[model samples]
Target: MIKRQAREEDETHTAVQGCLRDLGKSLGYDVWIAANDRNRPLDGGKLGDGCLGELPAAVGQAPGADAVRLIDVLWLAKETGRIVAAFEVEHTTSIYSGIVRMLDLALGPEAHALEGMFLVAPDGREGEVKAQLARPAFSRIADLKVHYLPYGELKANREAIARFGEGMKPIQAIARNLV
Candidate 1:
């Protein structure tokens, strides 16, 4: 049962990442899936979502580039090439690792005014995510205004938003404020 549950969670994680990638692309931002996840099947294509071969010059040259590259998904501004948003689908894994990865990009040499830094996870885990962010070690995350994107919310509205949503506004509306 435990193993089956784990597999289920992993599938959800991949799905959420795929949803985010599609949403970002439709909203006119370039999407990127984590390097390790690129080959995973998603949305009729691999999880890489046909992303750029490398991180944009803006983030690629910044410190912690390696860590930032591993963030579950990113939405880059079309013109500036800056990362407008970063997401880590926590699913059933350690939220701590996701937060750490977000922090790496947030605190990197380049000052990124991310439109949203989200932890996409199961709705039941909201409290766990809040507890982790409340820790002193992750204090900056609060300042960064990291948010929680419940899988239910994303899965439910992803299609409508993709067709009619403008920019990140619609996506932000679905996310819960954790700061």
Candidate 2:
């Protein structure tokens, strides 16, 4: 049962990534999915920081706040020449409050680096999550975007899934979608 659940999680994660890639393509951006467990040497091996130790304090502070860190998907908006829009996907039935806290940390810095920050959830709870983000504390943060894509949307988009699952080459799939 444990292994089966793990496999399900893997499938879910991959589907989320595929949806993201499709969305990025539709928006004319390049998408790169970060490795699930391999953190860059910098940022103390944090998943999002690409440079070794040069990331701002905001990016590194969330771990201590009990936030669950997942692989960060980076998107480069071609029109803006900006890179590193970090996104997180949540499929857990019970919402994790720490995720909002972590977004506060990650977005502060990522907003400056990329076009915007996005939180993708498939459980139909995006409005509530966006409301939480709209609080004054998180409002001042620039270029933050919230979107919710139902699992049905993903399943309906067979071309995108095939492109994403063709291999481990998600980046290539994203590039193809752009063209």
Q: Pick the candidate with the highest lDDT.
A: 1
Q: Which pairs of residues have clashing backbones in candidate 1?
A: none
Per-residue CA lDDT of candidate 2, range 1-179, in tens? Answer: 98999778766755566556555555455555554433423324433333222223444343432232343454555444345555566665333443464365454444465433445566466566656656666554333443444455545654565455532233232221100
TM-score of 2: 0.47
TM-score for each candidate, following the candidate numbering:
0.92, 0.47
Which lDDT values do the candidates have, in the order given?
0.85, 0.47
Winner by TM-score: 1
Off by over 4 Å in 2: 22-27, 37-71, 78-81, 93-116, 124-145, 154-179
Q: Write the per-residue lDDT of candidate 1 for residues 22-62, one digit (tens) a residue.
A: 88988888888898888887667777846766888878978
As a whole number from 0 to 100, the lDDT of residue 129 in candidate 2 is 63
